[model samples]
Target: LHLPAPTDPLLRALHDILRTDPADNRSLDDHGRRIGASARTLSRRLRDDLGLTYPQWRTQIRLHHALILLADGTPVTTVAHHCGWSSASTFIDVFRRTFGHTPGTRPTT
Candidate 1:
């Protein structure tokens, strides 16, 4: 698979982490410091390279986790907690915005 050769050591380190399955929990702040880059640098790279900010990417990851939980008959409360939402209502709002339907209103079994 072709991948961009990173321009800096900091970015190269982050690129390796990015290569891993994103579902694996990773903290951008910690990764940034480990590679001698600031959190802002990491955020910029995430947006410039991946077209998303770190938080946005993380939120998307959590939302995907929520979908899996919901599909597997997990309770909405459990899903929200596990997916890192502050509350079920917030999770449902994001869920609806992203998927165009609320969790309880989905057609899936």
Candidate 2:
């Protein structure tokens, strides 16, 4: 299944949380607590309302921010950290997979 339509309220709330802390590397339970929802409820809501699992959605959020940071001339290592990646290598791998190029290859704006 795909993500919820852009107009979905659930997507808005999730976007708010993500934008506030794009580097948030917290567990699903921690995210649930921050939003005043139980982990199970958050999981269910994401699945039912947004057609996404927590990690899947978070990865998309992180990658989007990574691109922005890279374009703005943030160091690739710093972008990795800012995007909540455990390591720069992992970040490079995911960035390459998602964007078809390594983060280092992106021309800075």
Which number leads on TM-score? 2
After superposing candidate 2 on the true structure, give the runs of residues whose Cα lies further than 4 Å from its correct spot.
1-11, 106-109
TM-score of each: 0.68, 0.80
Residue-level lDDT of model 2, residues 64-85, one tens digit each, is 7777788799999999988898
Give the alpha carbon lDDT tens digit for every residue of 15-98 in model 1.
566544344455877877677888998788766776776667667667766777788999998888787777899889988887
Maximum-lDDT candidate: 2
TM-score of 1: 0.68
* Candidate 1, lDDT over the whole model: 0.71
Give the per-residue Cα lDDT of candidate 1 at 100: 80
Candidate 2 has a TM-score of 0.80
Clashes of each: 0, 0
